[model samples]
Target chain A: MLGAPTPVLSIGSGSAYANDRLAPAVAMADSGRVSVMGFDCLAERTMALAQIRRRQDPSAGQDERIGALVPLLRGYLSRGGKVVGNFGAANPDAAYEEFAARLRKVGLLGVRIGVIRGDDVHDLVTRLDCALPELGTTVGALGDRIVSANAYIGAAPIVDCLREDAQIVLGGRLADPSLFVGPICHELGWDLTDWDRVGHATMVGHLLECGVHSTGGNFEDPPYRLVPDPHNLGYPLADVDDGSVVVTKLPGTGGAVDELTMKTQLYYEIHDPARYLTPDVTADFTGVTIEDLGDNRVRLSGARGREWPSHLKVLVGVDQGWKAVGEMSYGGPGCADRARRAEEIVRARLDAFGSDIDDLRVDLQGVGSLFGDRLVGGEPTEVRLRLAVRTPNLEAARAAVHEVELLYFGPAGGGGATGSVVPALGVTPAYVPREQVRLETEVLET
Target chain B: MKLREMAYSRSGDKGDVSNICVFVYDQADYPTLVEQLTADVVREHFGALVQGTVVRYELPNVHGLNFVLDRALGGGVSMTLRVDPHGKAFQSLILDIDLPGGRR
Candidate 1:
């Protein structure tokens, strides 16, 4: 309940996804506009990939930028600026360890760091045999092939941590918007169960969670929609009041925060504007109104909320094995024809592997790699023939791409040949009872 | 005319689903967009690329239309071997849709 009479909470965006540029985040921290900054460092597939890394090395799966980030965050933490992020990725304890060590190294003693756990429901989903709707099977069906299962958690643990005076909070699979929602609610005295207030906070969180997306990172086009300083686009910050918020970026930073930018991001990944399902609340953004305040500021309001969903959505990571990709360029007058011939040769060669290769695709880059025949245009002067394959066996994946390398001797005029294989992991969604997840937040003073 | 003449779009992915939102640059064209860009229309425009259902949601207040295409990506983002896994290019591909009454 620590809020001024006016009660405006200013929170800024730190990082949008794993490996997001640190310079912009540093800029936001030093700008002095926000007292709290939320960083969303995980995407749908990010956790699965992080899990793969963890499987290989016990201490390697957390966000890799913490070492570089901690020194950068020193000034902000000294000024009493709070930070929250899903930097835990697949490892919350490792993230906490790194944060503690780094903060102590920087002489920032007495900083309270909160570590949230229990989002990992791999064992829970397995025991419950949760149904994986996308995979058309149960978690038990996947057996040991299922690598990890992490629930998309809400702002509840974050609020709990903040209530205990955590200067920094990090967790695994914290829903992107919840990173901001917790801070806003915690700072403004908004109750976690207050649906409308949480919804309003969620709307503001959604706006800033994507970092530069709310500003202008992905809004630029050559002629139709253009923003200034796209290369240096700044992350968005929100001035949140009770029912409304004004989202804007730092001064003179690239990108705009006008009505169009706000509208596009508001519904960017949202399927239904009226009912955006998040762990915190069933937020309704349909009634939201956007007003351009000029100079990269947009005021948005009218977000309502209903009761939270009883079931929580969990991302189950399945061991998809390996994916191999090989490409070769064919140029000149008969490039498309030569590329097709190259594809035929590669296909016939790949047929020997048979069922070892699960999914096989051969496409000409400029011809029909994307959109298929829907948008395949005229004959191109040059096109790259790309052969992609997926398999449970890495040897088969490597051999499949090795066939592409053999193309140098098979097809005429095939130049600049390349081949590579990488471990692949697929993530699917499953619903579990919310009560099944028991979040534990431990606050540590450095 | 193509929808590109009157609107802008962005596509995002959640697992195998792709949601592409289109907002008209000019508010007057919103109704026409709603009338012409139905789920069926967008499905047909995408053809075999979209193996599942197409759902269109209207944003009247913001003059926008959101199209959620199910099983649109070749599996999920990391699983899909397609050059554009997340359908990041779908935004541009959607602009190529034919809108009969769009302003040139």
Candidate 2:
């Protein structure tokens, strides 16, 4: 069965909680005779969300969905398929254990699983903390206010999983694109030394990393026209053979996998195509080409890449403290003028009373208030003025409200009260690349 | 360490800043595959690729490297329309490298 190579299938989601969003794609893989299933999840936001959930419900700790997502994998496994994913966020070991337990309960005994680690590249943050040569002029602007850092993990560890005969592999905090790239190299028997093809696979992985983004779900220019269903969009699949790859989606699904969509995705989250960075290598995206093969399919080939350095970047978040904001609207002739005057009064009041308004910004909506009157862009006439302040002191931040009431009596004050004050959240610390977190690769008897 | 491609865009008025995430991996025979695999080496490698003014930092605690390739991609300080969009795949192409274990 493994000889013909059951079309290798993979799925990627934008968030950790997108299990439902990723289900359709997984289902399609099963129906299309896919042998292995993998998920991409290096989203920092997802980690933050998982942290919140862990704190609230200790039982629902890390790997919150192993029981949920693994069962689907087991169902496929029952049909002689395999599953793998980077469901491990801040804690991959914990996720792996949970997955193993889930499999044990389902009677999938002796399921050899592997966990890939050693990608926390936070040491660079210290160097960056002292002096960052890459940021140039902007380095001084940020000062030492960076919260977290993390190194982008690559596909080498995934290959380790393949070597161990693992039916399933889990990763903690790996780059989303790496999930797709690893399997392609494994299936095609492509050598890691083959930088060109590996880079091409990485390109394909990047295109579909955000799940439906490449399939025209989030596209903008009268965009991809992703058919059948856009809201409940289906993820894409890269059916490859020889030296080429065809991007497509399942039948009776929603999404466009054509040249335009691929092109749009290619340019989405990229900064420099010439030196596209990852945990693997510096890819040359400009050297690649794309072709639309009709039927929601696009063929990608002719890509090149280079060797990576010896470290990973770590992203970390720190406790930045709390903030609160309140907005009030003003309409009429001098509404814009009134908003500005009110803001000045509030600032003066807070400043006079010993309030900790470390970061204070009041935005005038209707009247286009540019950064120093260089009004190049913005809504010409804003009707609402949003006044936001970030302070360590909660009482002081609340006391600033006095300034809002005074605005009504000012020159532009035409409002009584329209909106309520919204409290900003206490920022949490998110840490990035921190030491090479080690994981021993072992073939579990299960 | 050369400019393989240039993707610029005027997405918003948020200046022409490109956030580069360099990937560095360990050699196949390396004993401890730490964050070092994706740090300084990756940054310096790509810093050369863009052929632009560059700044770099070593995230020791994170075991990775970061580089800020400045004025590299094309974009306008104003206008939300990113006249040039490099897309994420472009970055993947340039940073593409081989795996340690070769092909499975």
Candidate 3:
């Protein structure tokens, strides 16, 4: 028999990204307010890099914090707290094994671990020659340059694993919100197909998925927007009930979780509010309402949902050769002009490589790099000229980097020159039928 | 008055697509936000920073508008050579847009 719905399901966010600081996660896990913690460890940028790391070492693509995190979460885990994370970035087996070993080391026996596979449809997309909408080409056209393709799986596997009493659940490229939705649905006894309830669950998941972003990580601006104690910002947690959720941070934590912070996060990564598409459902957040409950607590509701998308999004990684970045500072009188001259020199020098370099640009940092011509600041006493290049030709890439280091000879007062060359893994999106990705879930006791 | 004086914004990305949600600090100013901060105004302000379409969606419940800009991040992180590949700085840039009049 299914368990009755939880009157209120409390879940907290652990890590927002792959390299996110673990201190906040430690605090969130230690708090007794949440029964479940979700870690969204993979991002659009991290996924591509994870693929490269896995390619170099067969067992390297999992979340690096698994060892440290396991110990930090020991107290909560021992007390029966559950975890759901996309910890298996490019390799699920590696993540699963790490969790098993870490749990054993922490003296936590009989912990059930769930492994969700089949998100890695690298071969399936290649066979189907999936059309890469971003690249405007098919998978077969790229050939071996295509390194990896992982679909953003939904909460089904997580819910399945939880049903089997999995204490920790992990998978590769599990949609960020799904990491939380899975646990919420499982504990709340909410049906996967119930559009409205799932939407509410997704709303809660969205609120907690970004960790401090929901609290105020990127929400500060001097003289305009400010939060209390910005340094000690606490990770966000949710108090989810039937149709509504209250988003707040731990007491005494830096940052505010008021109506403004919650609203910003509500539509943070969402594109179309009316059709916010996830692997599980087409969520509609247009009518979502936010009520400030004071004391760093805000209630959110009114998120609706329709049917899920017909196809799942697959993030296909392309081995885009190497990226070279070179920078040098020009200071004192006429710094802007000198920086412009430096750019001209680099552009002219890089032209020798011709079309071998896919893309190249040079920008003056203090003057116009970020906003282009839109927001031009005053003539700075010093400006840094940054030249970046993407090229299939490794030697050309290295040559571009070397040229920047040689800038000391050309521009007057051009000191602090720095250059770097690294493999650039580009990602493009492709859609495949949901049935094509046959996701499998395995729950086993450690 | 400047939009930044009465409003705040946050930008996010999905590949080449960028979304910025702007909300008025006061609920009473929601109408002015809708009237002055149209998609066209934002597109023009962004200029070449955005190469594709700019579509705006209103969130009356939250007193905000979400603007989705296509081809906004200069081909995104890996492929683009832009400094801020994610256009994260766009949020600060958008707030510079002028409001209809001074409320002070």
Candidate 4:
């Protein structure tokens, strides 16, 4: 028999599948078994891509999938299910405007939705320029080149939406873990001082953030890989109460949801067992335990958390000078050895030409030794050599790579350097972390 | 040793969980450092600082080692604390592990 209906139910959508994604959550709400339904569409790596893409194309449109999900989210709200989604891309304000327009189109004007701003913490980029006594580094030197900055807003405003009687909550850039955090604030009416419960929810949020990852999508088990469902994988849901909660999924789903999946996801981002850092709070990933309750239900309790760090871990990319790389393929009897020999020849030639190479990075893709760091024991018949060079001089970086073909025509190893040689040089931005970032929240009039 | 990259994979729910794989990165002499810093080695090294049984697994497919420290983090680990609830202790603890490669 099912226990008490959870006041909050989270649905983690792995990716922005289309506007119609709201249908699944709608069905759950129709059953009258849940209080709030959330959809997570952001990908960890996708955020990086969005940062790079936005730099080049300032007006890039919303991702096709995210665009489609907006209206469907509006429809879910019209149907009486309190919907919340993370459709905010690099431009959350833009996404919010578009979503607001969509709500207006459906005759559901003035929906009174909430958008958690202030997480964009980009301004902190400037503060990190000068080094503080505690941090011992300059701002611009540390996180000055942050491509994108975001603060992980907590659940205060999200709970505000529930109290405001808003039907939906749309966030532009909330941390994936906060999706779960927002709901707990609505449930327990706990203040930020409730460290233990907040810690428990943070752990739950982290485990549940990746959706299926906690259910078997990325488990290390060779025999039971990625849970069960390959195509129709179900999103994870948490029925939280007090200091614990149960993780489960819709019945008959393909993926596997057991103790193993949860453990793996927990280990994914954890460093020390005592502290796990996020904008919301710092949790100890090592402090968690999983109890598999058979038939797709697992209970989580005793997960504790500590106060958030004074400074968030900022990933700022700055001008690390310039780097250019090109690739050449080689095959045949000594193909593996030949590829290495060709790279050496190019380096030799570049050095002979007075190349002031600050750093020369060579990647023998199949060889597995790209950064000259890791070396693989076995060698394949063919090898692809991706050579990169970093220097203050762009021409030198370019000239050093331009010699790839010279080796192909030179006596060292000519046959292996085949196919088109393309230039791959891009400037790397330095990364810096500031002391603190401002996190603000706003309740939107839908 | 520096904690270079920490990657994770999940299986089931909260309770009755199987294993949490943590890959530790050392300096150039990874294997030698790993041998000394194996879960058992770590458990032995931090015996006074920590408690419970910790197991180490070798991942040949990837160029790293995995540590399965059972009930060692004072509580049932994640069950006792949230992984993403922000805090300084987690990072400090990671920084506290004296490594064969070097000390933080």
- Among these predictions, the greatest lDDT belongs to 3
Superior by DockQ: candidate 1 or candidate 4: 1
Q: lDDT per residue, candidate 3, A110-164, as tens digits?
A: 9999999999999999999999877789999999999999999999999999999
lDDT of 2 by residue, A1-446 (tens): 35775443343332323343647645655674455555665454455444445445554435556677666666676665655577766566677788888888888887888876554333444545433333332222454444334455778778888777887777766776677677777877888767777777788777766677667664432221325567666677666554566777767667677765676566444555666667766776765567778988788776668875454544443323334455667766666666777777777777854546656667665453222232234434445655555566766667655556556675554465433333222112222332344434554656
The global C-alpha lDDT for each of the candidates, from Candidate 1 onward, is 0.90, 0.54, 0.91, 0.53
Candidate 2 deviant stretches above 4 angstroms: A1-23, A44-68, A71-74, A101-110, A121-149, A222-228, A328-342, A345-355, A364-384, A394-439, A442-446, B1-104
Q: For candidate 2, lDDT tens digit of each residue in B1-104?
A: 22111111112111234444332222222222232233344344444333445554332222223445554443212111111223223244333333333322
Report the lDDT tens digits of candidate 1 across residue range A195-225.
9888888899888888888888777887888
Query: Residue-wise lDDT of candidate 4 within A361-413, one digit each (tens)?
Result: 56676665321222235657777777766565667766765687566675444
Candidate 4 segments exceeding 4 Å error: A1-48, A57-64, A72-75, A83-86, A102-108, A128-137, A141-149, A166-173, A220-227, A285-287, A321-325, A345-359, A370-376, A389-436, B1-104
Quality of candidate 3's docking, in CAPRI categories? Answer: high
- Report model 2's TM-score to 2 decimal places: 0.66
Least accurate stretch of 10 residues (summed lDDT) in model 1 chain B?
A: B95-104
Error in Å for residue A67 of model 4:
0.9
Q: How would you class the docking of model 2?
A: incorrect
For candidate 4 chain B, which ten residues in a row score worst on lDDT?
B9-18
What lDDT does candidate 2 reach at residue A122?
38
Error of 1 at A343 (Å): 1.1
Q: Indicate the TM-score of model 4.
A: 0.67
